[model samples]
Target: MTVIGIAADFDPPHRGHAYLLDRARDLGDEVVVFLNADYTAHHTPPLLPYRLRREIVLELGADEVIPVRGYHQRFPLAYTVPVRVRLMAEEGVDVILDAGPSRNLDRLREHVERVLEVSDLFSIPPNVPARNVVRWLAAVEYVNRELGTDVELLLIPELEGYSGRKIRAALRRSGYSPDSLRKVRRHLPRETFKKLERYLKARTPPIARRKELLDVLNRASSYELCSIAHLNTIAVREILRGRPFRSERQVWGALRRADYGSVLTRLALANTECRVTSDEIARIALSWCVERLVPENQSPDSMYRRDWFVAALSSHGVKARDADRLYKRADSYEEARRLARRRYGVDPGVPRFETLIGEARVSDGEYRPAISANGRLGVVEDGFQELRATAFGATLLRYVLDDPFVDAVIRVEDEEARLIVFPGDSP
Candidate 1:
């Protein structure tokens, strides 16, 4: 009699597993399924234990199911490969039909003849209800090359309903008979159902901070400190680390000194150490910070506060055009200060620049607005107030310029620089 072998993680043996196995039974007289070991799934842990998963497979109509265990092996799948192959040979099976040409099946096929591979017959562009058709076809080609056999492979498109993980969860919670696999039925107990529901409710996708900068930035408090230049300097470093912040303070610290250009430059290097692109991280982080610190509800248009509009503009270095939309009502200094107090918790009359200068014992007449040769707005030298303002502008300015807008900026000798803006882009 022909013997067929199936290898799968079978994390929860849903309708898809049964659908594939039932088709395997039709092609061969006996079916042997090798369940993936618990440790084998370390890279991607399965929801259920291997033993229970094997039992679930049998209940779904697998003829013979076996536990294939190994420890301390570089390739555990490699060890189980030979064991299943020998079982096929000892059974005196002439022909073999496998669910798909997996690594273990390839090992078995190397020792056998008349190997048949059944794979994704139903897929898009040319076939039926499955998405991974081409992938299965590719696996068959790989097996054919390794085994040096003709390998009669059939592609079958089997339609299946219900995912294994959801089914496992449903059964455990309802305390229903696991045999209710064929259909959705009330087999689990009420208490089990409640517990399962609670467990599922608590289970959430891990917040991927390292995946994007925005993801990290969005989690910070509205009052978190931020800096565009800081982000630009450290974009590559943070992306390489790819770990979530332990506290709001950590995220706040991360928001320092970044701009779109610096982000683009760092990402352009494409260092293997940094898995994510610089732009992606910057965009995510910028968007996240903006969303919480300066939301649409608190936007210039929604709330006419000049200080807020100025602060937001300064933080991102927003131009008059962009700032105009956000704070259309703030046409004068009084309005700007009034809005600033409501939004930024700053007293517009407090005179931060004057206070800092007074503390430094600098004369007010010595406070001259520094100007660039290009005849554009420039930051003051030793104007500690300008340093703070520039830092704020570094956070809010929407444009990145070649000219530094701070108290002191590094420049290559005789290298003409562009006017630097915040968010690191030109208006």
Candidate 2:
């Protein structure tokens, strides 16, 4: 039995999606779709929830629908694409069906080969259109070579006149009203329109996790923010510069002024919402490398020097080839830094202690109260006391106040009251 596989967001499964599924059915006996999770690859929540999107796709004619998890949402395509291609290979998919700008298969293959040869998908030239197409093609080739799989690429011309962005914008503008559905009726399949209308009337669409995102943006320390995936020192400073953002738009404006592109801005917001730390991404990458590359009996320690792990290390501004070289030569992280500095005459943008605080802390207690950054009731002092807290201390205090099980510890030292907070279960 031949199985055709496709990976997509299918945010609202329109006529374009249905057409692709029809083509898949024509070519193969079974069609499997790997749908993006609650968050899309672009780092935003779907207009509809994952459950609704999955149901829509299944209704549209998918034999099996698998959900890609949060790990894909945390990093750039350079890191996640290989993992996705590996998934398709492991599923026994014979043909990977996708739509690209060009219909020339030989040209696409050549482009993919060139990218893999350089080992740097991040440095694709700006003049090249459809970089994602190149990235996917490269991923399929890389995974096929590594896993010894025979997954063939099937490229179809991109269907025109159905823009998911325009449909979503209309829905939002009309508040998901029935009239809005009617306006975009031509773009959606009959089944998709009916399902979406019924779903929208019965329940409101799920919104982005803006409150959680703002909570992290307004409260998280610079050091804590730096630990999030896709966030560098400059990005963290941009977020900090726009203090106490009232909404996501304000944060977007700040990032835009700092020359952050749409993709990076969305990634920042998504990372903040999920609180995805760099450490977490590294662990996920290491596990993926071990699973796909390492021998079953071999130690996992050797997995760190592999390609995927090198890609993960490249997140901190190191080039992929350079990271691979440094990984083999340097015994420790500090040694790697030293080598990079010597070779490049500059640090590879690693997060350092000095970057944590761009400004000095002031000791004036009256100016900086003991309250949390969100202005919630953090501390109550019965007697006279002066309170001064560091950014890290305030962040911890905010977390402590938010946790229901933790109790705040208050101490009185000679006429000054100090707040000592720790996270623990209630006695």
Candidate 3:
């Protein structure tokens, strides 16, 4: 099988790159592209990272992408023609394709069946959309003049101006939204847009995670970790600044000093090797809250920023925790219970503290004087003491109600009464 060789940076393959590959594929059995390695510097405009660029090239339909690692470093004195020729020979390639103008066609001819050169069709000045024709003609002439190789220079003009410069410039100027970029990308063919999106994602400056953090702050509650949310947001933003947000404590201190914007901006600018996943962040948020905000014995009443509570629990892959945090303090019990069930698999039948309060009494004496036939406080000693006792009673009621075998009996009849029934139905 004849192996066709293509030289490419393939930084998120664009339409022009795809055109060359497609044209070459028709003339060969297998096509192999020499990819720029992570360290190679390609003067291609709006370049993406090497790994991402290679992936895009693959997506664009390259049969194989051979990493051209150390090529530039090792062949610093040689032009692209010699280096590529050496690389192709190693791969046992027969035919060769160059997207750029071939500078050394005669030399290349010695190593391959044919050397084809393709140009960026879209980059031609719109006024003279076929400007590449001049370049193509010149390339052919160069071969005829320099090497006496009358080699054919194929001209594939990209009509839409899909150059990296154009794409980047357009993206910066609001000529396109990200969503619009994705939609219009379809017009460029699969491989082309894959390269484009890859380049954009790789080279685009990281946005601060602070905005997301602040958004988190809008909903955090006390029972969750307030400091952790602030820290996570800061840490993510710090990554953008080329600095890692090392610890929750550091984030907390920075937040205490109201240095939020500075750290956030830093993290927003720095890019991580891995983008933060929602599940990962959710887990982080949950841990932060569970450890910081919602400590074992703390009441939910003192909390602020309810969103943080919800986000933390949800972020931690604990959908149940998130639902509980969101609904636990709801004004309506049914609403709270319903949300708990739907989001977290919490059964509404679980006994509440309220159920216990109504069924238990602190003392028999306290329960006795209250029952007047007319529903009046029949010579009660002190209403304040009674109120305090009742509050205590309510808490105990809920604790016991949680027991599966305990059936609480709370009654207010004739005047007032309450009781607790156990497994045997005895009160």
Candidate 3 on 390-409: residue-level lDDT in tens? 43343333222222122233
Whole-model Cα lDDT of every candidate shown, in order:
0.37, 0.64, 0.40
Select the stronger candidate by lDDT from 1 and 2. 2
lDDT of 2 at 194: 82
Q: If both were scored by TM-score, which would come out higher, candidate 2 or candidate 3?
A: 2
RMSD (Å) per prediction: 20.9, 9.9, 26.4
lDDT of 2 by residue, 1-427 (tens): 9999999988789989998998899999999999997788777888778887888898889999999987555766766777777788888889999877765667766777777665545545656777788888877776777788788778888788887888888898887776689889999988788888888877777553367788888987654665575665456667777889988889989788757899888877787788875455545554655555322211123332232234334544557667667755665546766776676554544321111111213332311123322232223334212234444333333333322222234343343434432222111
lDDT of 3 at 400: 26
Least accurate stretch of 10 residues (summed lDDT) in model 3? 296-305
Query: Model 1 misses residue 258 by how many Å?
Result: 16
